[model samples]
Target chain A: MGALSWAALSLPAKPPGLAKASLDRLGESGVAHPVTAVLLNYRGYDTLLEVGVLLLALAGAWSLGRGEQPAENPQSRPLLLSLLRVLLPMLLLAAGHLLWIGAFAPGGAFQGGALLGGALVLLILGGLARRALKRERCLRAGLALGVLVFAGIAAVTMALTGGLLQYPPGAGGALILVIETAAMVSIGLALGLLYLGGQPPEGARRSLLATPPDHA
Target chain B: MIWRSFDWFLLLAIVGLGWRSLNDRDLFRAVIQFIAFGLLAAVAWVRLRAPDVALAEAAVGSGLTGALLLSALARMRRREQQAVPPRTEASE
Candidate 1:
């Protein structure tokens, strides 16, 4: 039955269900990336709400693991440490490239930010960077930055254009870039912290020189 | 014809990995299987001509989610060990 259904399915003759006008106006929308234009310009409100949803997820995770300190694994090998030193910077570069190319290609804030988040997780696993409890304020601020920046832009754009997030004709691209950059940073930090499972205690630095666990 | 065969193979791998992960008794093995599923899903997205979704699936779907699952697993293991202290051979 499944094979019959699969065989029956075929691509449409004329690329069904896309608004031709929207495709034509994609370039004029101030971003060459059609997906970006659609996500941040045509449907900016939805993107803003999505960022809020990410924040809500983080909030829920934090509450669930309240007052729990992340357990340290001190058994990171030197080889892994050296590898990460080389790899982390490369990942950051790739992320930056993705963020930049997102203006004209398939990359975007979410993809780039996720790469950064992955790098952060790698750093944590390698014991190079620790999530400190004392830095909760900083973490909180970073988490909120994306939504705040997005909402601020929405309000400002509303004041200027008399409609929410309606960018001025010539200024749309720059505004979207600004919003994407802020969103990328916030998303990266939020995701990385989420992987920690709980807040780290103040002054918990797992140094490279630290002794490995006996099992290692 | 070759491309169609490859697509079928990819589809089978995805299904097989998903089923294995769902049924795996070892939580760690399940997490690894799930990560593999995510990567294959990203490849499927790319084949579908949506590079944007593919990049997202590879990055957030596979990488970050895998890390989250592993950390949660670690925490769970720690809790389990604490709850069930080792019964020494002498005691047994």
Candidate 2:
């Protein structure tokens, strides 16, 4: 019965509300990707708040308890290390490409950041990267950078344009790109930290696996 | 017709998996089933023509969430083992 009802429903001839109008003028919004335009321009304030929520979630997770200490000088299997050496670069490249294309295609800051987060988790699992309390300042800055940049841009644009988050004419694209790059970095770092679940111990061990033979 | 049938099958699979995951007795098995459900949900998102949602579901939903769940489960298991030894030794 539920399936039948779902099947019976038909898509509207045109999108409801302002979405159609927004879609029509999306290109002029300085983003080729309509979704990006909607997310970062038409409704940018929401996205900014969403990034804040991600940071808030991290804070909550951290408050739950300190995570178990990671092993010191942890060693990965030579094969796994070699595989990661090859894989990590490709993942980084893909993340970069996703961020770059987000302005014109289906990719965006969130997707790119998530991929980067996945890569960071892989590195952590492989013992190539360790969370360290000493690095908390840097990590916190990275996590907050997106929201800080976004709010700063909005405030500056508001002063210039007399409207919140309204980018000046002819500069919308550049500003959005700047915000997206900052957002991508913050999102990536925030997600990575969230996966770590709690404050890392001081001086956590770094990966000490020997370099693969073929690389030498 | 074939596409419609495929969608139906996909929907049923999602529902079945969700039910199984929720009702599974073992925490580890439940977590694994939940991850499987997440992957299927990604497929369903793709079928709904929302690639962005599908990507998020696949990456954050299945990948990261699954990792978090498994780690939490491991910690719980370790605590249980620690608790059991003391109690069992006392009883013996």
Candidate 3:
């Protein structure tokens, strides 16, 4: 029931002690990013709430899985597709580097992993999404297993640390890395799973949804 | 600023993909376009100093979304296949 509420602090050039501490950790002076510490440091209650919000969103997505399917459309040329095919992966990897750099600079796990996942999404949209799924039961197991393992770890942390998710100050960076990484995988899996369930057939959901009921 | 050169190109791709996604002749392409838009948006995030948000955008926005969309496509394909039953000659 820990709601992780992040403190609102101006990422201006100079600020209060908390801001300074945060920047020092990232090895930067500016504080443009939301100080997760304020949320994580002092607001254990809110972090749990944030997890609840995520859970709600996940629930909503699952609820939306009743629509028909969409028909295919023509896409851009082969050359452009080829170029993107080459470039997207590189962009994602760079994002990961940025995340690691954020430990002593700016850019952290969330940003880095997002970029990587984004690239994967791009590849999938380009008509390659199917290959990744493989229709294998093991893949499904992996998806659920990753989530379970993360949850188990977090629970263990709560037991050992006397808080829902407090890592030692020394291991702060490592903790963030672990959480964000797991988040990336789980989020990607969830998104992909939703798509599989929610898309409508040839705008069937849209058309049906767009047209209201008759005045009987 | 390595992102500079790729910025405009990705932007164009996003717009093109998004527009096509929303109003293409085929419903399926639209879903794909939406996924592309998410990826490009991630690039924009990387440039904009919000790695965390970008990660959310990419994975949640595109990855899972694309998978969901593809499944939807498969379902539609199944429906289509069902509609056109093979070998329906007059039963003598």
Candidate 4:
């Protein structure tokens, strides 16, 4: 999905077409393409590990934003805001393409998603205050839901195939694609919010609601 | 071919920019140079084959941190503006 988006946007520039090349090379044998093999090897476990790194960034960003709830005043303008719109989707596509190509080369799910997360962070900083205003609970629920879905998939795999995060070898390609696609959305959302600077309006309102009334 | 050796050049740029950014005499120049350092660092990540790290570096390094620094610069400018009081004595 990202790769397709990238291709659509990068129309004239036309960065190297790894997907076409990789697809053509599928008719051959072992580790033929350095880029794809680096990405796709071991059904993309390496990519998963790299994604954990971005997860760490999310953790780190989240930790830094404590003790204050910065309110969103819709008045903040081009203070790094407009660029967010232009850069984000392009970054997503680039990351996706890179990760997909990595299935044959050095790109992997983790690296690609991290790039997407990075773009997300840029957007947040550029002042897309969406999640920091009203989307807090829905966003958290989304993160929890992602974990549940991943766990459910793994459990079902274990029940049917006696192993978790495991898919039949012949179906590895399709399975990896499915996992990567799901993970792209799940991981990107968490990391984007983590990098966002402050609490959404609801969380702030909730905290205010939690405070006991001042004693007379 | 030159682009392939982009990693080495990128590292060199990062080191040079980092050193200048940390030690420059002018505070404003130092901050701008720090952003350059980040851009170089991103290039290095690309060379290292970690697009993930590169992207994060670009965002946090240049985007967020850079904005923070620029805000500080703005405040400093306003302070300087106020500090240079109106000509009360006489014109040179």
Candidate 5:
């Protein structure tokens, strides 16, 4: 019965003309990639909400329980450490390149941010970013920065153009870049934290008391 | 004709990997299959002309998800090892 019903249902031969409409108005966003323009300009609200949801997920994870500290001693793996030393800078450069080329290519904040998170995960695995991660305040700020900046832009643009996330004339590209940059940072931190699985260890407080004060 | 054949092969690989990932008895092997499935699916997305989705699928779908699953498995194994033996004598 189910197979017969499924076979009886005929789908449309063509999709709705949403893509045509998007392409027709693509110049307003000033980006060569229609996907990028749609994501950052035409329907930025979705991305904003997505970032917020990621932040909420991290928050919920932190609230639920603490992540177990990695059992392996990173110092034992000299080869891995050396490899990371060579790989880290390349990852950073590539991530930045991806973000920049997003204006004209298939890369963007999410792709770049994933690379950044991968870098963070490498540092964690190598025990390189322990001190930096210890700065919980700084980490929290980075996690929230994307959503805050995106929401702020929405409010500002709403006031300027009288519509939420509607960019003022000639400033759409620049505004999108700003939002993407901030979102990249936040997304990277959030993904890394999600992998970490729970609240970071508080043992860093004791270490801080024993050592001299240092900036993040 | 060759390209058409390749697409069919790709489709079969994707479906086979997905099926194996879901039904495999070994957790680790299942996760590996899942990652491979994600990678192939990303390729399929590219073949369909959605490079943006392809990039995301490769990065977040396969890479990050594979790492997360491996770590979660490790944690589960550790917990299971710690919990297997009961401590009855000390409780009184």
Candidate 6:
């Protein structure tokens, strides 16, 4: 049966159908990177839906219960703290570089966002950005910003071009950049909050504010 | 070729780590194996000429997932310890 099926299935020759079309029409997306073009222009709806799904997953995780703090964690080791001090800035720089290079290279919002998320996770583990992260209002807004911006762009483009996410003339590059920037921020915050496991307690906010920033 | 052999090794390592992680009795060890699996899978993605995927696999799949798993493992252990009664000499 396996051999029969293999024989029955005809393999595509040279470039596949969509690949040929995509290569021919690559300039229409205006993104130098083929992957970026497909992700943010050719099949942007999927990417938009993906960001929404990620936000939904974070929402589901948050709804579970209040997050419990790690007990007796030696996250404040002098060695780890020092390492974080050096690593944080470099990681943030690399994330920004990745986000910018996505237009012409094999990097994009997801990769950059993941790196940003890693940095955020490090900040959380080191307990350095406790006060910043505690800004629930800002965090919530940032968390929803990706999908909001992406969908907003889609709607705007739809109104202008008569199709969802269809870029208006020469605006594909800038619009993708805007959407990706918002997505990177949202993804990083969402991942950091996911590591937090659930919604933090109300009292913990007051306590964190009282403690000195360098206490960790 | 040397590259072909390396690819075979990579494949073996990925499969072995994946299987071991799934079946391991110890959660901590399993998570470590899972992380190793993810890293190897990232290498495989790179070999397949998908650098974008390779980046995501390494950053999100290995790094974030591993951190999350370890955090959850630590929490589970802490909760279990809290639930169990401490045995004193008198109780014994």
**For residues A1-216, could you state the per-residue lDDT of candidate 4 as single tens digits?**
799989888887766866675656453323344454434433344555555564556566556553222334534756555666677778888877865665555555445655665675555445455445365666656555444545555666667777655554455565556666666665656655554333333344456437645642
lDDT of each: 0.84, 0.83, 0.56, 0.60, 0.88, 0.87
For A72-126, candidate 1 gives per-residue lDDT tens digits of: 5646377777888799999999989998899899998999899888887777777
Rank the models by DockQ, top first.
6, 1, 5, 2, 3, 4
Query: Model 6 - which docking category?
Result: high
DockQ of each: 0.83, 0.60, 0.27, 0.12, 0.78, 0.85
Which model, 1 or 5, shows the larger lDDT?
5
In angstroms, how far off is B14's CA in candidate 1? 0.8
Residue B60 in model 1: lDDT: 93
TM-score of each: 0.86, 0.86, 0.49, 0.55, 0.91, 0.88
Q: Give the range where candidate 5 chain B is weakest over 10 consecutive residues by summed lDDT.
A: B83-92
lDDT of 3 at A143: 43
- What tens-digit string does per-residue lDDT give for candidate 5 at A1-216? 688867667556675968998889888887778889889889999999999999999999999887865757888999999999999999899889989999999999999999888888888778777778788889999998999999999999999899889999789889989999999999888887777778876555655347645742
Best by DockQ: 6
lDDT of 4 by residue, B1-92 (tens): 88757756777778899999999999999999999888788878787877656766775567556655765575567658876675442443
Q: Best to worst by TM-score, what's the order?
A: 5, 6, 2, 1, 4, 3
Colliding residue pairs in candidate 5: none
Fnat by candidate, in order: 1.00, 0.54, 0.58, 0.04, 0.62, 0.92
Count clashing pairs, candidate 5: 0
Cα interface RMSD of each candidate: 0.6, 1.2, 4.4, 5.5, 0.7, 0.5
Model 2 residue A170 distance off true place after TM-score fit, in angstroms = 2.0
Candidate 6, DockQ score (0 to 1): 0.85
Runs of candidate 3 exceeding 4 Å displacement: A1-52, A66-77, A134-150, A191-216, B1-92
Which is superior by DockQ, 2 or 6? Answer: 6
Instruction: Report the number of the highest-lDDT candidate.
Output: 5
**Which candidate, 4 or 5, has the higher lDDT?**
5
